[model samples]
Target: MELFFKYLQYEKRFSPHTITSYQTDLCQFQEYLKEVYDLEDISQADHAIIRSWVVTLVQKDLDSRTIHRKIASLRSFFRFLVQQGKLERNPTLRIKAPKLAKKLPAFIEEDAFTQLLDQSEFSADYKGFRERLILELLYGTGMRLAELTNLKLADIHLASSTLKVLGKGNKERILPLNTSLATSLSQYLVKRQEAFPNNNSPFLFVTDKEAPLYPKYVYRVVKKYMSSVSTAVKNSPHVLRHSFATHLLNRGADLGAIKDLLGHASLAATQVYTHNSIEKLKAVFEKAHPKA
Candidate 1:
């Protein structure tokens, strides 16, 4: 199991958070096997045993998406074992998780973002500059929270107006930064240096204590600012990302271009934003058409 974890960490290049979730799911399954079937080795478990565990997850009334993720973990673990010759066959081949409902990704309206960024008044201090930059980058680049947190000072190329984002699986992609966002980023750097004159931190975004930015800090800043402009239930960083993609698509950006900017591994992942665009079109049609 430890070797498999190392494989995921070193070979797969999955983020620590993802690796921890996989570990949690596998450990829970191991405990279930120990308590219910007296099984010692997960490699020896058959498809029937794996299905039974999934059944228990369903009985717990877990969300279908959560159950599906757990099942996916089992599938990946068993597949790795088979490749390593620890098991003859994968035990999760027959295991099926409940189907997930098709829900469109939630995004704040473009006018809300315009109000948040253009009309809002942020302080002139370092903290305010940092907060403004966080919103600009998330909504401008469509970067994931992990990607944003992992960003370093070296990733920004202000002269070229581009950003190098290290995405999932350690894939690096260069995103074009608009001139306005580039100017904002450049100004933030000045404020950052002014705030921490003698301190040396390699990260682009940092706490007031001169440490690298963390998830919760970014979330709090985003939630606080977005609340004033958006009434959406989810006023989070991801909503900003969704707004970025949806707004671009609504303005006639190509699907493939948005996919590359968003760092999606497949077109299917990028297609979700199109649903939001379609919903917007439906709203316009209902409001403007002659027929009721």
Candidate 2:
């Protein structure tokens, strides 16, 4: 297990959070093995034992997705053990993961998004402008909260109207900023300087003490503003990102372009937003058609 985690961290370059989740899932699997089979090492794992574990997981009322992830983790772990000569054959090779239904992404409506931004009160104060800018950038650029929180002053290219975002796997992508969002960012930067004149945190967003903005703070700011606009959907930063992608697809933006803008590795990841747009179009057509 330690070897597998080291491989994930050093070779696969998994994020800290992802590594932690992998650790948790594997630990749970290990505990089950200890209790059920008295197995203490990967070399003793076999197909029959793994299948019984799957049955046990199902009996525990775990969701299909959770069960699927555990299976995937075990499969990878067994493969690693095989490669390391701990096992002669990988038993999980024939094991299948449970099929999961594709759930549609949640998004804010277009009008509600506009109202949310317009209704957000921003004072001349540094924190107010800074918070507003954070929200604006999330919706405007469709960046993930981790990407936004990790942004540095050097990442912003105001003259080019682009932001250098370091996404998952330490991949860097340049995302463009529109006129309005760029302008708002400029104003907020000035206010930020005034608020923390002597501070040198380099991060674009900072706290009251001029420390770098944490993910929790960004989540709270998004929730606070979104709660004022609508209570239908859960207010969160990712919702703003979904709103950004949905609105873009609604406006006829190309899927490939949207994929690049959102820093997705594959077009399939970007295709989910089309489902939201299609649902919206269906509603509009149903309302307007005479032969309903």
Taking every candidate in turn, the Cα RMSD to the unseen true structure, in Å, is 1.6, 2.1
- Top candidate by TM-score: 1
Please give, for residues 1-292, the per-residue lDDT of candidate 1 as tens digits. 8998999999999988899999999999999999999988888789888898989998999989889899989999999998988888887888777989888888887788888888778999999999999999999999999999989999999989998999989999999999889999999999988889887788898888888899999999999999998888988999999989999999999999999999999999999998988888999999999983
Q: TM-score for all predictions?
A: 0.94, 0.91
Model 2: pairs clashing at backbone N, Cα or C within 3 Å = none
TM-score attained by model 1:
0.94
